[model samples]
Target: MIEYGFRLPSSHDNRPLKFEEFERHLDKTILVSATPGKYDYEKTDKKNIVEQVIRPTGLVDPIVEIQETKGQIDDLIKRLNVVIKNGHRGLITTLTKNSAEKLTEFLVEANFKVKYLHSDIDTLERIDILRDLRLGVIDVIVGINLLREGLDLPEVAFIGILDADKQGFLRSTTALIQTIGRAARNVEGYVVMYADKITDAMAAALSETERRRNIQIAHNLKHGITPQSIVKAVKDIAQHRSTKLKGGKKSDATKVPKEERLRLLAEMEAQMDLASQNFEFEKAAELRDEIERLQAEWGL
Candidate 1:
């Protein structure tokens, strides 16, 4: 049970977690799981999860809701109506900016006070949108990639995930964890997921949710006193001077796709050979070390 935070496991995950030790660590972890540890699923024990004891936080177990298509917007409306009656605000996440826009448009036309936040919106507008949401001018907000992380809306009693089964990096376990986290701010927050199939990604997402929820509950049980909402302050790499990237050209290619990673390795080896011929031992040695490390990472 690692504290709730934004973490992406790296290739050689040998480093010790720096988070609070009391938060139970996970048995297996993948690239971006809300769970803990460095191993993958095979190494994890399902029985260990069953044995997990729970403690109560003052917050209630939020009612889970679900809403799917453009036609199912009414389901969302009913959910929202329940929250509004309780004087709660709401947040909604979509798979893409286009989807978010359509939902926002539909919600507004329905005469429900709403707004949207996505990459397309300018910074000032984002600030204004957030302000309006906080002030109660906008009862609901729709977002794609932006609001999933670093968003804390205490009044948001409802957090709706518009597409529960679309599978991709943005729809993966990590993103779903963040979207769900938005509702963790309120004591009575609820979450809704709308989809036809439960994807492997969704399976992973749900597993992590149950894992963390169980941990938090157990912690409260032992303490005797009710626990308040515990937020994991996310690591801001900008804070640590050493974490900043040194000056270099940015690569357009996001991941080192296997094909490209191999090509780059070959190119580096050739360049290293050339450097050795030119008596550039320093650069040659550096490239040699780089190639060796990459080979080890691939277990080749």
Candidate 2:
């Protein structure tokens, strides 16, 4: 397992690893893996498996309410169902695919608008599911590992976590905090965890929740503005395009030559530089990836 560590590329450079350094390192690693003979996983005409994994971006958000586990999951669902039946949506996250599927089936058969997503769901279906949920076409989405990070839906008013005290990455303090924080994006959002005995992770999650809630409330009060619903505030989350770009346009990916690639690379570098100057690290990081994809022969 790789424990992520911060490495300064140069003494004067302060950004965490960006696409250029990461890709340059990738190229160096590929060079090392190749012998005089023929094939290598890194050198093959293939894309990286790690790049296929999704990473959603945003600040941490969740407002949680923990309950002791005497029929706690059922009770949590009942409360959440009331909110959903009344026209709001809820989310439930389990630690395993089996659990997510079972719960999704149970909820759907019980007449709630629900679906399950894991690595199994087709990419196209997943995109539709996300959009439908936002539009109120679905009331709940239950998932195992897929629900964490980068996956945002502001209309969800409740999040229920089952087996919160179970230990693992799926049940860790960071995981619970990230899951529950999904609800914090909405004004009336909240989380409920069904756990018989609270663990260290549970304790940490609760403390973090209280801290974030107080801070958001304080900010709202000081500004003399009411805290808004998650739905109302999430419009800026996705900056997706309406239609596919035509090939002749500058941003189109197909049919570009080496000259065009370098030109695009320089253009993206300027954006990266501007972002660094403005202290917008996330934007800078995105542009870095764009530059890499634009420059890569394999478009990896």
Instruction: Please write out the lDDT profile of model 1 over residues 85-119, one tens digit for every residue.
Output: 78878888888778888888888888889988766
Which model scores highest in lDDT?
1
Q: Mind sharing the TM-score for model 2?
A: 0.60
Off by over 4 Å in 1: 1-71, 227-300
- Candidate that would win on TM-score: 2
Model 1 vs. true fold: TM = 0.56
Which digits, one per residue and each the tens of the lDDT, describe model 2 over residues 1-300? 123345444645656888667767664453331112244453555564222111122223455666887876578668867877766778887878787888888787778888786676643355557667877888888887755665557777788888888999888877777777667566666778887888998998788667765665565566666655543332321332212122213445566666777776878788877664443434655565455544553363
The lowest-lDDT stretch of 10 consecutive residues in candidate 1 is 236-245
Evaluate model 1: give its lDDT. 0.66
The superposed Cα distance between candidate 2 and the true structure at residue 282, in angstroms, equals 16
